[model samples]
Target chain A: MAIAQAPPRERARPARAPRTPYVLIAPAVIAMLAFLVYPMASVVYYSLQHYNVSKPWDNAFAGLDNFRTLLFDDPLFWQSLAFSAKWVVTEVALQLVFGLALALIVNETFIGRAVSRALVFSPWAVSGVLTTGIWVLLYNPTTGVSRYLADLGLMNYGAAPLANPDTVFWAAVLAELWRGVPFFAILLLADLQTVSRDLYEAASVDGASRLRRFLHITLPHLKDAIILSTLLRAVWEFNNVDLLYTLTGGGPAHQTTTLPLYVATTAAQSHNFGYGSALTTAAFLILTFFSIAYLRLSKFGAR
Target chain B: MMTTQTTGRTLDRPALPEPVRLPRRRHRRRSAQRVARWQIYVPLGLYLLFTLVPFYWMLVFAVRPRGSDSLLPWPITLENFDTVWNGLGFGIFFQNSLMVGVASLIATTVIALSGGYALARYNFRGRQLFMIAMLCTQFIPGAMMLIPLFEIFRTLGLVNTLWSLVIAETVFQLPLSLILISGFIRNIPMELEEAAWVDGCSRLRGFFAVVLPMLRPALVAVGSFAFIHSWNNFLFALMFVSEQEKFTVPVGLAYTLGEFSVDFGALAAGGVVAALPVVLVFAVIQRYLVQGMSAGAVKG
Candidate 1:
């Protein structure tokens, strides 16, 4: 094959190269199939079976019983799904607003831009557990920020935000927001940099106001980036359980339990793999539908 | 059209008066400078406080004495660090996390490099399907895969082992790393590789001699992403590894948080320890991060 296909000048190279790509991608394909795709398929399979590690005798093919229970009987399922929706919307929206602002601010030629970029974006690298740890200290009643504020007669001492049901949602939101916003800032800033300065200059020269310039040039340019980052962040915020698990423990009576957290609880604490897989399936369907809807509605990359 | 009209208007305006325009232009410039200054600094200042205060609070609690409320760690103490490091077994967790992180980094980069090269260089039969599959995997929540992954790991006898974490992290990291590396490899001209081949180098040797050297930044970006993600991963480490010694940093910190009678100082200390490596790595690679995202993500 090599000799037949080869021209005189390219005789050194072989035409037995069609299989090279498959061979190269074999490891990745195998790994993803083994770890990722296989697990997903198993989740779907187990969602239909009564698989519980604790109760071996009860294990049998459930055949949509888990889904039936999830859709009809489970109040916590609805509650968690609602909370996940609320959580994702609130976090992504706020993060986008603040992150875009921060990106715009730092994108300017400020004196301390380098240091400020590093400092402000540092929280992004911190883990969810670590973010929980830091916020736990800040929200601590006795020796935390409340005590210091109380010392200055600004607010009451022993104000336990995480413990209070009324405040826990906002408390979790604020903490997650701190770490989450930097992601938007970093991504938006990246896109912001690619916006040609000449566009802005041309707009300004045309007597366009700053807001108009942004609306016309910068915003349009960042349309696809904003869409991509928000979708990714929405999925991430919906799936993330680390901060809520540690900070509030989805507590004050499961006030903050996202669907993923609920699934984790079911699987880990109750050992109900079947129910957990059902919840997993539900969450997966919701995300897939939501993402597809979001992309379609946003008209992603249409320009 | 807009640019031409604006230039034409500017040309017409210059005919009115040069002398009158000078002071007006200077006045506009001054006010714009003033507004721009406030616009940059005020919000940035407030945001910096928001960003830095939590970190500062963590540092204060980590360093101050158990009972002190001085706000500042005037008399710095390492007692919390000492207790968490040795007593709470974070020492073992740290070592485990490092092993997992480094191992995942190596695995993700090497595999992604091969897969990315294939994607970039080949017009293979299943190329479109492969790319689409990688994209679809992004929507599969890691948390949802816990039950099945746990079952898989248990079947493989990898439960309570760090290899479970390494494998899980590598799988999750592969799609993005592969995409990013392929995007990068696509940017490098094929002529360079062809030139190397023309000099009697095999395709493999051409890649190593010509392409690999140019792929340093992409490798670093992909490698660091794998390391940071694996190091911070909690669910896999929590579910797969039950033993104390097999714990990662996140699992250790989560346990510290879960204790009924929480020790603030030790928790803060553990948080700091968990934060150190990733933050440092982030600080170094952050410049590339924006660039990498722009190149690999936005375009894709």
Candidate 2:
């Protein structure tokens, strides 16, 4: 029934003018041009110059010099890039696993479904800084959960996860997972609701176990949604600088900085527009490359 | 509109039952469904603890007397709220945030509605290209855009103004909202608009009289999305607004967080302020979330 929503090509001889679409699209197009497109073009332009805000005299075209320094000499650049990869992989994988489980559980026709769904999905609304704020209170050594546990004779009191380089990654991961899982759960649940109950009914009659039914039927049905959401989540986790920036300040010694965090710190603090722009361009290219290959390898939407 | 398509009932039964014992088997399946209640609830209960504790912790810190380390909030004080609101300048920040959030909500929704109408209804030149361009923008890391966006805003003398935040938020919000809203407008059967036209309503009048009413859920979904995103936008607000008076909630929270001797009370209080509007918005529009998401999911 809903497939009837496809645009009716046969009704093309309409009373509407062709310009109506353009007119409707004008505001959006103009905004994107002025803000998104123009700024993007200028990022490429700035990457070629030495335009630090502190030194106007140094503002000259540097060609590939910025990229050269980034590729060859910058240890922090490579470190941050590697961390970004690790961060994205860990966040996306964990979020999907837990999120899928949560989505499946909530998809059942159980008691208190509405209220439970609302409670579980609540974290998706919390912003990154707010997330950091909440977790900071939880992770603050003296005033945090560990102190309580220690006072109850459960563990040592002075172990602050965010202050330690070894545990900081997982510390940030858990906090991010709180918010990230709900996004996948919501998307997967939407896709889950569309799976025809008759398919399950037929499988049940065929004496298929629940596990086999999920493997054979539900998995294939959710294939597209899973792929699409995971890809989007991967990119989002890569770009999200708010939580780490606020929580760790990208440090207890630069152990937690993602590439974008580096770019933001560079741009905001050191006023290194040219080098930051170069890093920005590199990150954009990497994302675009990774996305194209990921989509291609996954054979997304082909069915 | 979508709910009608999901529910199954006896009216859908064929002239002959698909299998002779189908009714009996369905009852067995219903009993089987009853068997898994604990499987659903026990783990859900644990996960809910994981989810709700952080929220509860924030509330506890925000209201508990400043030096009392009591686990459960009792004999709550308004001191933290007062500190962040009046003493810490969040009162000004909240006003700024609301102004930015609402302005961008209006801007993003109005522009997206029009652009979405085009994408949904009238196929035209460069339509596919436009859609592709919008999708590609998703991969452009927003954090990376700080340098160039700052440059553009500086050029326009808008670096410290709230308008810079509004414009940046609206632009980023546009791509997804446009696609989602277009997907929604597509799902509203064009026949409804055509029928209105046949009844002597002009196209615009037909849209207002018929289609717009049906679009309430989608509009709310899209509008609230814009509002939530704008409100939560941290980096742009932080980067653009250096003046404390111009700060949004996130920037204020970031400063509160950055201090070595962080005021847990004030930080938690500010966290509550940041969380309040979006949570309320989420609560209201969440019923439509699955439906709204499914439309976009089906499209792309």
Candidate 3:
């Protein structure tokens, strides 16, 4: 099932000409080069220069000054990086636990399983701003769930979770989890369906308890999927700007700003392309290193 | 020898006749069934609430009149929808989003199809490098690319145009779509195309005749993914297209969210407009989503 496995040599190969494959892939190759590669290269290049759209008179090559400033002078950099790490870990870990549970629960034979799965997974289709919109309506202090609950004598009258620094983190986390868990559930459920029923039956025949069967059979089988999904999700959560941007606007004194959000504000609002590029390069390095280390440490696909 | 024979006979006998052992096993089985039922229903019920509540809240706000405080959306009003669609310029945003989504879908699918075909069938030079490059692109943050991409679009005079968003969306989408489509192409055994070619059809003709039909599910999965992503994309549309008429659903919805005095009803209505197409597409393709992930992403 590994993608790196060589294509079967026995199948009669068509389109064997040297030029044909290149021709077929030209559009994709050209597009990536133009957009992805070129912009990435330019980001690194700009990181070394003093490029600000607002102040052309001061524009010049700054060498490592931007990085130096980011490494030393910028407290917000450290704060946002710390927040990004916290955000990724908490979000990914919670999403995995709940997602795995959701997948397992739905994997069971139940009535209305199809509709249940659809209803549960519907949030995965929602966009970040849309998620923000839905959650905003839910979190509004005057007219939202809090007020409704207050009407029922369940709790207080005003609970502005998004505005309060203490509750904003979890508030955002919950909104994200509403959409995030379904992704892991979908991927893990797909892999779950492929597990051999015979293995479970054998475990049962051996007088193994349900927990033991799950521990011995299902967990081992889902190892690769769990690793892959968590890694992808961690990266996604780290890079994701839309939900946090629209939901909180990195508010309450920059309590919710991720690194990428910081970069966006720097570039789009401040027009500080040079420093923004520096931040972008740092993020790229961190992500690349983290991904490599994760794959290595997890022993991905070792089984 | 007599004791062993008795034990063997007991083992061979149907458990139904062994009243002492039967009840215990049946009891355990029944309890296990009960536990399983509760385990499935209780958590699923709770999670369903968590999932559906926000959507229900949005629906409530969208339908309820502005001044009403009723929990239920009684005396339903289309006023919010009318307000956002007509007044807040979501109609134009909706049209723009549709244009970008459809264009991105077509562009991503067509390009990824060709590129995916190459990867699936042809073991060309740089194939491994190309695959690795595609994988590496996953880590490239779209938010990070805003500055350089803005510059590129400015250089090409594409800034503030829908084409800029279209191109940006297509480029961002190409890598994953290519990988997924290529994985799908590999799953369709190469023999099918060879069989078509054996009937005097050229490679292109063979692909159209034999392979194209079977790729419906894959194309649907990839195209809809592209469409949904493009439609939902905020930063690119935000940075690339600033014109009011060129605003996509996300950008427009973001503006509504960013307003000084928030309009809850209008915002929810706009949210509905933003959500409808993607949610409909998702429901139609929800069945294929897991299958697609297994075939194209996880297994690949």
Residue-wise C-alpha lDDT for candidate 3, range A1-303, written one tens digit per residue: 345765554345543567888999999999999999999999999999999999989899999999999999999999999999999999999999999999998888778899999889889989999999999888989868998898889989999999999999999999999999999999999999898776765566566777887899999999999999999998899898999999998988999999999999999889999999999999999999999999999999898
lDDT of predicted model 1: 0.87
Each candidate's root-mean-square deviation in Å?
A: 5.8, 5.0, 4.9
Error of 3 at B183 (Å): 1.2
lDDT of every predicted structure (CA atoms):
0.87, 0.87, 0.89
Report how far residue A52 has shifted in candidate 2, in Å: 1.4
Q: Write one digit per residue (lDDT tens) for candidate 3, span B108-227.
A: 999999999888887877988998898899999889899999889999999989999999999999988988888888888777787787899998999999889988878988998899
Model 1's chain B TM-score? 0.87
TM-score for each candidate, following the candidate numbering: 0.92, 0.94, 0.94
Better of 1 and 3 by lDDT: 3
Ranked by DockQ, the better of candidates 2 and 3 is 3
**Candidate topping DockQ:** 3
DockQ of each: 0.45, 0.51, 0.55
- Tens-place lDDT digits, model 1, residues B80-173: 9999999999999999999999999999999999999887777667777888888789888888888888888889999989999999999999
| Model 1: residue A251 alpha-carbon error in angstroms | 1.4
Question: What does candidate 3 score on TM?
Answer: 0.94
- lDDT (Cα, 0-100) at B197 in candidate 2: 88
Ranking by lDDT: 3, 2, 1
